[model samples]
Target: MEFFNKTGKVAVGSRLRMLTEKITEDAAKIYEVYGIGLQPKWFPVFYVLSAGEEKTITAIAKEIGHSHPSVSKIIAEMGKKGLVAEQKDKTDGRRNMVSLTPKGKEITIKLQDQLLDVNAAIEAISAQTTHDLWKAIEEWEYLLEQQSLLSRVVEAHKKREAAKVTIVDYQPKYKAAFKALNEEWISTWFKMEATDYKSLDHPEEYILDRGGHIFVALYNDEPLGVCALVKMDDPDYDYELAKMAVSPKAQGKSIGWLLGQAIIEKAKQLGAKNIYLESNTILKPAISLYNKLGFKKVPGRPTPYERANIQMELDLRS
Candidate 1:
């Protein structure tokens, strides 16, 4: 049995990167299930606060992998939610120091205990396994720190926003161009697997078989693009915008934008206040589209997808 040989930092880095998401997601779920009172986005804030030092927003943002505005917004929200408090730094009147409140401290202690328990569980399962897990995670964090992953994530996020697509709902005949459109895009742009552009035989299966919706972008009788509104299991969550694809031949025409607008409108029509999309950073244009449509950067470890690698959401007041 012969195996292919591989070496180099990118190869190692890429392999390790896969764990970045799965571990982050598992950690978040554990914290949430334990009622730890902190969202994944606030992990860096918690880490900073745990250091027992009063830090300004600028310092905190710099230390963590997040933009100043992003940190400020999360901090503001945390304060509102009673997780933290803000006070002017007496030594420097211009600087505001953010620190955990009494409640925040209490929550942090609980989270710390939960963290220890999680570690203990892993250790109990196997000491060697526990050590390797921490080692890999630490290396991944160090790499992200060196690369300023937050900034890259932010930039990637901005690209998605700039690619905002408006959605519109119309008849199937109006979408006759969808088949050709996907074929061109798959061939020219993404070089996607053949399976990526397959047609949905059971249109009603999408609409009624499970949580689903249908949206089509029409250029007269031509279907320039298509997207779906998928219902998730979480009641607190609204529907997700999935299966977004554009015609390779119509890439620059903003047909994708029309589809986005249509999805939002349709989501509102269904009484949904939040709409989300799943995509990837590699597809820079798609990420830009989501950002331009009002999606904010969320600290989520995204999984792979054929055409996208990032997940974004829009809040609608209806």
Candidate 2:
């Protein structure tokens, strides 16, 4: 517990492992006291086979909520201990069937009586705790299922790395990244056309000089993502969200989300009522990101780019 004073904030895995080891140590001793020749690790497999029915290896793994290889290893270990029997299915040589042997059935009889006392012992211990440990563990498991620890940590790391991405206004030096990033994505998915070149090759004349704004995301002094808000004269919309592209090498770093958020904020600052965008349905990730930013599909308008099949708009008033 003294180690918690320094590393409690990041010691969740350590703490869980410590508790598991302590419980397993006591469980082994408890099994010995009951004269049950079972390892704590083998309890789950034993429980599954205790139903007195033969099940395929895959079925056993599914019932126990474990991986096939892991369950197979445990079953093999139990088979060696004479607690379980396994054989290849008569119809299918590839499928293995497992069930409790005579020795296993006898052990289950002893385990039934032993578990009754163990359950009460566990309840007695739970009564002394400030929080219901079993319920807390169940909740923790549900939360982890909703979003695994790996996914949570990766997302956090992405946000942390994205913090280093500095959003800057269009500059002469960034014009290369502005063009290159767009060209990379467009040429990868769709053929670049005159409209694409007009904005990408000459941002100043096509977008900037027309009172539109372009933002570039730079990480470690390298510009990797760019998005432009083009000024429009349409009464229904003020600006068109266009030419957004993040480099292939720079994806999954939250660069696109950051750039999109920045452009939306810039549109609000410019007193825009609605922002419009055009994209192909094949670009699902881009569509999803736009939806996250509150953009919804709207009726299409006449467009110049052949790649533009879907139109969406964001109502700023909402």
Candidate 3:
């Protein structure tokens, strides 16, 4: 109780352990009152062997939901007390089959009547409570099966990190990440051309220094996606949205949508009257996203790459 006061209700494992110890202590007391020298922990193995079938250590461990080592140790103790005996499995020489001895069988018969009294006492305790502890424990076990505590914790951590994603202006440190993200999608869909290599290998020279801007989407300061607004030669308002790609691992987290929105906003701020992009019609998701962002199909323009079948343009002037 003092430990509960210090740790509060969050120490679930500690509280459960305290409850188990208390119940075990009460069971020991009940066995002593009946003049039975058997420990409460040994009951599981004894009950299993009493089923009149010799079971291997592995089988007993599985049935009792205890580790093989723990069951083996308990069986060793029971062997010393003349309550159980082990024999080499006939089929498998490596396995040891266990069964209750004559003394163990006699003890089980004697304790059969005592079991009703112990059950009544426990039921009386449960009757005083508003909720059934056993039912609550069963529900808790089912919920844990659907999603483990570790998985829930990991999902929460991923959400926390995803929320931290920020669209940042390109920096030298992010150059490698920029190339990797773009290359992942591009190479998967189409072979990377010389133009792709030029832009990816030298973003600063080919994009940034050419009166253009590059944005990197970062989650927890790690770059996960990249988008670029390439300045056109004819007019300042004309721009090309190119070299946009998101890491495959970060696909479902909407890193692509984040980068798209960021680049659009950046273009608007920089006096972009028209934004153009070249993509393949086979890239359905990307094309759909572009359409949602108000990009309409436009006349195909001459491009350096063979995969450029679909051309789309977004008019910012409207």
Candidate 4:
């Protein structure tokens, strides 16, 4: 109980289960006080049978919202105690219908006074609570049906994980990670060229020194993604969005999107009218991410690398 209280909302499931066990235990004691030998676990099935409906086992299970096997087990226990009996359906010989036996009907007659008293006690208990548990449970179930606890938990997990990733300005310490992440993706599709190595190996001279900015996505002080907004010498564009890559460990964590958005904002901050990028259509996910970042395919320009086939540009003015 102490541990549950300490955990609070995080232990909601455990707390609810514990609470149900407590209620069931009290219900058994209450029935004992009324001189009844019925098991609290069998109450739901008994209640459905006592309504004077000779229902098929399948129908009983559906009406009571329990598994057929569970209802079957309860009926078997009741049958041994001579509380319930089953017979073939008159219209459907294959269907096994069930109803309360004489003993069960007698118990129902005896339960009327106990039921009224129990109902009053429950009303008194509910009056003591600031919020009604019954209405809250119904509302909570409706909300869960709309967006399940699994989805809400997964979204929270993603948001918390993404929060751990910090976009920081490139440092000399992150040079190796920046190069390794980009090189891994590049080598997976096409061989690296001299232009790639020159920029990767000497980022300060080739990129930062020329008024361009490099950003690193770091999680727990380790770089997980990298991208460079290279100062372009072209007459048409102000920056080249180049060498974007995320570590495999950071896949599905929105690392690429974060790095891309950071670089685009940086380009816009530099008073750039447009951004250019070179790529091949073979990298579908990358192309999709680029397109989502508002980059559109444009006519190709002369490139320094042989793998360059698709050219894209993002108009910052728009």
Backbone clashes for every candidate come to: 31, 0, 0, 0
Q: Which regions of candidate 2 fall more than 4 Å away from where they truly are?
A: 1-11, 18-26, 51-63, 76-82, 85-99, 116-132, 233-236
What's the residue-level lDDT of 15 in candidate 4? 88
Cα lDDT tens digits, model 1, 59-104, are 9989986899999999998998898888999998898999988888
Instruction: At residue 41, give the lDDT of candidate 4.
Output: 91
* Global Cα lDDT for candidate 2: 0.92
Q: In candidate 3, what are the lDDT values of residues 1-318, reduced to their tens digit? A: 787889896698889998999999999998888877799899999889988899998999999899999999999999999999999989989988999899988888888878989899889989999999989999989999999988877777666666778999999998998888888898898888999999999998999999899999987777888899998785433889999887777755667777888888988999889899999999998998899888999987778889999888999989
> Candidate 2 — number of clashing residue pairs?
0
Candidate 3 residue spans exceeding 4 A from truth: 1-9, 90-94, 167-197, 204-215, 218-318
- For model 2, residues 13-71, the per-residue Cα lDDT tens digits are 99889989999999999999999999998998889889888898789888878999998
lDDT for model 3, please: 0.88
lDDT for 124 in candidate 3 is 99
Global Cα lDDT for candidate 4: 0.91
Q: Write the per-residue lDDT of candidate 4 for residues 1-318, one digit (tens) a residue.
A: 789778889889988998999999999998889987788998888888889889887888898788999989999998999999999889989989899998999999887778899899989999999999999999999999899999999888877888889999999999999899989989988899999999999999999999999999988878999999999888898999998998888876778889999999888888999999998999898899999999999998899989989999999998
1 or 4, greater by TM-score: 4
Deviation in angstroms for 162 in model 4?
A: 3.7
